[model samples]
Target: MNRITITILVLSAAATACGTSRSATGGAREGSGTVTGIITLADEVSPKTGDFCSGLNVRVTPTGAPEDVLGNGTVRTSRSRCSYQIANLPSGGESLAFSVKLPAAWQCGNGATPTVTPEPQTLQLRDYQTETRDFRVSCTAPSAETSTATP
Candidate 1:
């Protein structure tokens, strides 16, 4: 074979090998599963009567994988905007955590992400499938009581 043709074949083989190596090293494959969740608040008042998921963020990140994943939350919606989704999550023995962020003007009663029933509200996803987890944050405000004395 010509020298040029031989070099091209070698290069192509090398490229294919590298691609396979990446996939073996946990690179995401086609049809990866998604991690979807919704953030609801536990309060005396209902979200419909008070606040919705609008302007709120539901953040999801793989546990101990890295810092956090991007594009994992929902945006403000005209109606109820509480659902959040993290697409293309590499499924394995991996688990994910969900947290909520309120707008600057608002704050949770505890001033922190409420401890959802599941604690971190994690999801164990499987390949080519979607996993769902629900998180709850309390928006209830501290109540005040008054006392009166008469003489």
Candidate 2:
């Protein structure tokens, strides 16, 4: 019981079994993985807006975060509708790219028939798999222009 306290108790049980033998997957490792999605609004009328976007802003650039923000970077929705979501992320195994900005003059039609004709536009998403990927966005505005008005 004295060899330097049994070699410091066998190096503290081998450093707690190498920190619990690693294995969480979602934390991505064995080939790495992660990516979740949801950003809607591919109809009505929308195309020329800013303020970081009104109803959707799912940004991600993984592969070891090629410039900060690799998970839950941006995600917002309202401006009447058009879903939005971006969680966890960090799996850029397929060179990702997703962009949807609409809220300036904001018009995706069908808000009650604002010249209804599938007006809104501006929806792009690549690689896919932000959990499942279900994006849509269209641009257009007017009719008292509202959608949070702006910043």
The model with the greatest TM-score is 1
lDDT, candidate 1, at 48: 46
lDDT of 2 by residue, 112-146 (tens): 42242233232223344334455555434435754
| Worst window of 10 by summed lDDT in candidate 1 | 22-31
**Which segments of candidate 2 are over 4 A away from where they belong?**
1-33, 37-40, 51-71, 75-107, 113-130, 137-151
Per-prediction TM-score, please? Answer: 0.50, 0.25
Most accurate candidate by lDDT: 1
Q: Rate the local accuracy (lDDT) of all candidates.
A: 0.57, 0.46
Clash list (residue pairs), candidate 1: none
TM-score of candidate 2 versus the correct structure, residues matched by position: 0.25
User: lDDT of model 1 at residue 80?
Assistant: 40
Poorest lDDT segment (10 consecutive residues) of candidate 2: 116-125
